[model samples]
Target: MSDTAPADWDPRSPKVLDNQIQAYDEMRHRCPVAYSDYLLWSLFRHEDVMRALTDHETFSNGASRHLSIPNAMDPPEHTPYRRIVEKYFTQEHIDEFEPVCRANTEALFDDLPPEGDIEVMSALAQPFAVRNQCAFMGWPDSLREPLRQWIGKNHRATRAGDRQAMSKIALEFDGYISEQLILRREAGEEAPPDATTRLLHEKVEGRWLSDEEIVSIIRNWTVGELGTIAASVGILIHYLAAHPELQEALRQGHENLPEAIDEILRIHAPLISNRRITTRAVTIGGREIPAGERLSVIWASANRDEDVFGDPDEFQPQRNRDNNLLYGAGLHVCPGAPLARLELQVFMETLLAKVRHIELSPDTTPERAQFPASGFASLPVRVQRG
Candidate 1:
């Protein structure tokens, strides 16, 4: 956006950041097409966000300076890379990984006290997110702790808006991915037949993908999947703890676990927003946005827009299923939806099987994560296995 453009609101302001969902709710109604210094052009309404998602020509995903695989590409460039990504998350692969994902969940739960208080973010959400991500990529057990710590540093840098720090952190993540690529190459035929190895030989437009491109793809997967999965876990458990009647209902017969998880996440989105750059001048929500400006699709706001979902907070899974943007829509939809859904369902099924009840602590509230992240930063809950 031009520096001279008038600022409509501050996305980083205390009023907005303190309670992001509520702030966004207000924004969607008051000013759907909002402009700010931090987020150049932010679309808060469901209709406008949907327009941007479907119209790739006007709102291009090639917004990032660095390479970002299919997530940052548009159309022809995005198609083949997306195909490679989809293969890894196919039903066959998800079915194959289910047992492994469950084992990781069970091991994590085993460390928790049988009938006592636990911080769900650290004890349950983050660890399982990190470990399961590693397992999916066939990364070794050693990467689990480092990746967990790295996510913290990355989040801190992002919230601080520290460009140099973010760049360094990006390089740090690239290093981890690049090293794995090296090991796979060195092992040749002996390399484990994991997603990383398969990516090594993936072709697009009759050419092998560069090492840089490979690293970019894995980086997107690791960061996106890990953060959102962790947030989803926290949100799911916190919701269950807060609504015991529904929780008990599902625990008794978990056939609704998949639907319940989707509805809960839609109400409190795990992934907050994604970015784009305008390919040409466009008018959205009665506001004219010039070409070459940054655009942010506020998924958190769009999914909760009262116009579409009736009451934003109503837990109507079956009713909201068709319109839920949990995994997004159109050409740029998340390729790993199958794997992510499988992981969450398996994790919750295992948790419900092992634990008798989940309840939020009477004295503590799960601290909300700040902007750029959704869900609890620290979630305290009482778990009873007896």
Candidate 2:
């Protein structure tokens, strides 16, 4: 809506709601490379996203997307931090998390009434995921509720650009992580040898990570795992319930749950946008862009590009057989992807193992999260428990 928009760019309509994925579909088709006065360059096409993600030199992650994490850094510099962070989420660690993750999910599911309407998001998906995250990080139970609230608040405030509230919550979280770091140090242990320790003790640039850096790393991991995993659970459940055949396939163990999970993640990513910035002049989508300008990779739109995916809007488990940017692409792809996969699989398996059927409540619809996370905030449903 500003003078900075390219001549060919069509601004995303002002009326677009956070929960609507169709709005993103139109943006992908109509303005794959749109410009916004506030959000800057937005890349929607599948190829564009691939190019931007792969070409690290031209699109530096160090700019943090002005966001955070390996998502915000470039190569070399990003490598060290990512290396230490990756070690924390190794296959062994994830395998170790399964029992804990299952316990958390099962605990919440047990609380659900056998035959009554319930908000699955609040009762199960979200808190279950957040508790597992806290358990994995070795954070005390005292921090769980506040951390959950902070995760939701930060996502909302960041998107709305409410810096004051965002900063307040962020600082409080930082302080909490810092305190945990100190406690871990005093104990001469790294939070019971989980992600916190792996990150705290790993060397970066031949030196140990500073407490602040440790806090930052933990900050990224918490939001990444907790928020999106919860959202994905709700979205996946809603989809599966609405499509009984798929649900039956998963339950009967006659179909591919992994592929089904991938398809769902590809179809309905939780985060609305990831911020990236141009580090140098580059031509993309028939236009030349200068450096230092912010760009957002529209994962939701890219996932739905018709050019890359056939019947993109529809959920087909085997779609994009080889390449799907669902967990993202290249080096900056989610480090905890393995952990996320395990959690998602466990959620599907555990739910299917326990509940015989899932039915959405009549006259009620699952609502998508507003602002930062795009998946469901609450999905009300009735399940016939085993």
Candidate 3:
């Protein structure tokens, strides 16, 4: 029989879910490594998460039962697929995608009202994510609405920990991606030249990637770009709206946008956590666990670690950038970091270009997103256009 530690904290408690970041902040100070039935074992400190990240042998990424392509694979298998993914996110591709990303951002801005209060999620953040992903993948505009709805269903299922619902939601998204693959294959040379079509030609270990593999790749991209991007947009804007001096400084000098974006996200993570599992028995933050138990690497907590960042909320982009696990570290560092950076930089630039000021709406306070996700659920804000 395997040794199992008693529960250290309840992840499903109403308090934790109600305000995830604050709860994580408390947990990081109180019990760096905590256990709950839902998460099994959760590493809340920067040191613990980094150890799990850098040492892949002891801390494995093959935690998901579903096929996760490169992200879910280890070493020998993970290497080649990761190489393929890296190619798509190269600076060249990022440069090529900039104009399209900019045009999409501009079009979305046109829909925003010139001066009054706005529900940024529906008005801007959510739609921007859907459009950016669809445009980059060469998906049709018709898909924008369905994909938006899919993100809602996906988040609801994830938060509920409903495996059955999660499986169905995954399939529902797979079907959407599968149809695109089919269309590209049917069109042959006439198919739209986009990321989705390009993946059809990706080779792994001298063998063409299978349909299932391609879907998994796109699924990773959609989840990365849509949900996280939406959350990020809200977080970035919210941070700026709350800090007028910082917002004005950013507006005055557009060059500081990228570092500023990373720093803000470090304060409020767009992604709450990622999963890992122990290949063998190990101890983390003095908590013991047996082999094969799952672990939750809580990014939200790790990034804000007081030991690393001093004052977790203090904005120190240059000092904290090296330690920020925003994209992660080691073997599984996000391959799409370049693309994510470019998307965010352009988004901030476009907004700051036309909007003279951004302030939180006094009419309705922003609603915090629940566990499994971060950032505001509904952000009502006032933006003054120049």
Candidate 4:
């Protein structure tokens, strides 16, 4: 299906597809506000990206151009749903999730076959990342495979722009959540101190949420987290293996693991681009963007803008500035960022503590996922005991 991208679609090149940050930087400098027949206008500058995000009213989130969320809805209506989810993704909840995530990471690492080929994506990153979400939501372990498959189908549907497929999978996941809600209701209790419970109990639009809204909220979490986290972790692990010095540095200062994780995330910026429908005609970066048309703000590109970051391509874990749009910006910035940070920190700390060495397999190359989500299908590598 469309493996060869249009010439103007910069990041779609085979080489750049694998290394999105590099490709995004190259395109930003050459065509900051580029146009493709398919994706309309793409904005790449950091300041421009910031402006678009902050001006939420003009770039309304409920444009029906994309799926549900505060990501797709403006303020007033957006704020309440965001607040409901924000409470669950708070610093306290993230801290609570740390131990379980760490344990899972370590267990997966321990189980990897040593001194031979192992596809880290399947054996470690993919499963561990999804299971981490299950742990966070307190979902039954029985639902893991089904949820993972749902995630895959949902991702595929989104890329294909198949609304019917999206609705189908949405209902499938929603049905599962509905059953869970039934079980929780039978117990006549709130959610078990996790996102699900918070969704079940919280009010969205001046009243408690319905089962559909709760399921949609969980869908947002799974879509926002699962694949992107897995991809970022896979890429981070590959980098760590290639750069043993960095891995050693991280191992020595486990305290700086969080900082290290942030920097790595900044470098990779898992999800490639976010789409926003322009409410009014706006001229940005010398390009005229029309109202009601969609524009993509490339987070990967903005993170590497020379204006925002010096030597932008280099990986410097201790960079003190917020130059990256990895977590996005302004009104629609990712609310689940704190939880994501916690997961990354715990995973890195546990992985470093458990493994003596990590090396890429000779015949292995990661296969990047389709658009919306930038990640790998398989990341094969080898692990040595600590």
Candidate 5:
């Protein structure tokens, strides 16, 4: 066992959680490699984070105790499962889902007041994310409310570090997914042709995937689709609201919505951090970490590192596109990036095409989400009909 180092910082402190982006930026410079009880070691610099991401063997992703499909598995085991997951997010799949994603965005936009104050999280972001995921997975409309509630519970359990609560929440999610699997199984040949049904027939290692494995895969996808996508919407909308010129430029079609969206998200990361476990003793950012140590690559900090992107908050989509770790990098890079890009592009395009202007509510304040989550908890905005 390696000697325990003095605590470098507290990740769960109220001050840190209050404004995570700023705190992480400070950490990247003050203590690029920090140690905390909650997150053993956090790599905050872009270069250090890239090292961990690329050298998957040294910084393994199998950090979770629970089965996490390919997300928590190393190569050999991760390869085949990853291949199956990739099939669902292909260019062809995204193309087919584009119209459905647009319809979902339009329906939500139509429900918004013509020209008045609205809370984007509840009124727009959350619903758009939940509805799109349901449509993509062929889940029923009824699952929307439950899934939204589940996301809240999951975040709470994680923040509290209550394993029992986390396990219960995981089982609750599994139950919901298993029900979908059961219905498709009962329908047999009459089952609807959808992503969920397609998963029921996927094979890995020359055998049909077990119910547990299938549920794990679907759970991973659902969590990513629901939480990150919703957070991303709020971040994108909030940034545009604060920058009228950029908003108008995007609206006038002078800027590429997709590139702008990616750049904005990098400035304010939707997903804060992801975990890894050191396979052996490794020195990163001049800090010595021993084998079996858990590490967190803070995407929020790394993407904003000054060395990589001078003036981290500068709006330079094309100039910074190459190094942006918005969807991540390396073997465990998000497989759903194509679908996410398509959904965000469609949502932004529809919003710009339909709304003349989006501005923050003058009387209300936007609440930032605490750790374990990023983006606005509540974002009140005023919209003008196009």
Candidate 6:
């Protein structure tokens, strides 16, 4: 193990944080495997990130101090938990939840002003994510506000790298889920038949899942659903607003929504990066990373690699579909992708069908979210009714 690698970049610097995608693009070309204090060995190139993902033996996912279900687990141990997570995102489950997702999206769309300036993040993106998550999990409407606030706090703690605040925020989230579990336990047979209740009855390796495990699973789902989903909505809308031709194309017939959403997100990633720890000393992009070293696979950059895609910003869904790492790759790929895809597809379809045109707000510029988060923090747009 060598600790001789000097810092090549600062991930938290104003220049990088102000425009993460551009900074990552520059990093991928300049230093594919750059070392930084905040992210350690950051893998920016597509090839390097893919290698870490595929070679889980050399690059492990057990990078978190806290138990993160299958997200932070590696192999043999990761398989069963991953299987359990996959079950909830099956075609059958996603199909069943489609109507609920559409209804929630439609309800949110109905609340948008008929024709005027509006903030996409608040007016549509955040509420749509929160409502869909609550509806899917069988959580109450009351949780909508709390979860929204909790996600903001979680992002703030993460960006600040405040371990105590992060831990405290995590406990607060667990408390929210714990109350739901307690309610179901007290309800006995009358307990709501929701995902949360179903989780209580899930058996892993012949034993009922512990409260801690259940809370962890639910926490993972909640975080992914709230953060990524919200960020994605903003990105999708902002991209369309900026490109009226593509916006009109989709608005005419959104049958191409699934493919289009994937492509757009590839250009402007919603999820910035995922963490991994080296299990053995390995040389990647000519840099030697020792065993147990922490690394970040920058999806925000890798997906937009010019080597993989001729023009990183070009809108070519069919061309880029094969190599798109929007949901990631390898064994630890996102388990909730099916549900996420379905929700985004439905939301986009509804948005296009309802609003005739979506344009950037005349006076306000969209505010980009900082590290540990991606997409816009605030997206101001003007909507014209059909």
Question: Which candidate number has the best TM-score?
Answer: 5
**Range of the 10 consecutive residues with the lowest summed lDDT in candidate 2:** 6-15
- The collision pairs in model 3 are none
- Model 3 accuracy (lDDT, Cα): 0.91
Over 230-311, each residue of candidate 4 has an lDDT whose tens digit, in order, gives: 8788878877887788889888884377767777767767778787778888888887666776778887777777776777
TM-score of candidate 4 on Cα atoms, chains taken together: 0.91
| Candidate 5 residue lDDT tens string, 8-46 | 999999889999999999999899999988888999999
Candidate 4, superposed: residue stretches over 4 Å from native: 1-19, 65-67, 190-193
Count residue pairs with overlapping backbones in model 1: 0
Per-candidate TM vs. native? 0.98, 0.93, 0.98, 0.91, 0.99, 0.98
Candidate 6 lDDT tens digits, 1-386: 33677799999999999999999999988999999888888999999999999999999999998989979988798888888888889898899999999888888888887899999999889999999999999989999999999999999999999999999999999999999999999999999888889899988888998999999999999999999999999999999999999998887774377899999999999999999999888889998788989999999999999999989999999999999999999998898999999999999889888999999998998999999999999999999877
Instruction: Estimate the Cα RMSD of every predicted model relative to the unseen true structure.
Output: 1.1, 2.3, 1.2, 3.4, 0.8, 1.1
**What is the alpha-carbon RMSD of candidate 4 to the true structure?**
3.4
Error of 2 at 308 (Å): 1.3
Off by over 4 Å in 2: 1-3, 6-14, 65-67, 189-191
Residue 143 C-alpha lDDT in model 4: 86
Question: Compared to the true structure, candidate 5 yields what TM-score?
Answer: 0.99
Which ranges in model 3 have alpha carbons more than 4 Å from their true place?
A: 1-4
Write out the backbone clash pairs for model 6. Answer: none
- Pitting candidate 2 against candidate 3, the one with the higher lDDT is 3
Residue range 1-386, candidate 2, lDDT tens digits: 23565544333344456445777788777777877665678898989999988888888666552346565677776777787778777888888888998888788778777766778888878787778888888888888788878888887787677878877888888988888877877878424775675666677778887776777778888888888888888888888878898899888888888998988778877666777778778889976678787788888888878888878857677757456777888878888889888888988888898888888988688776765677887789888888
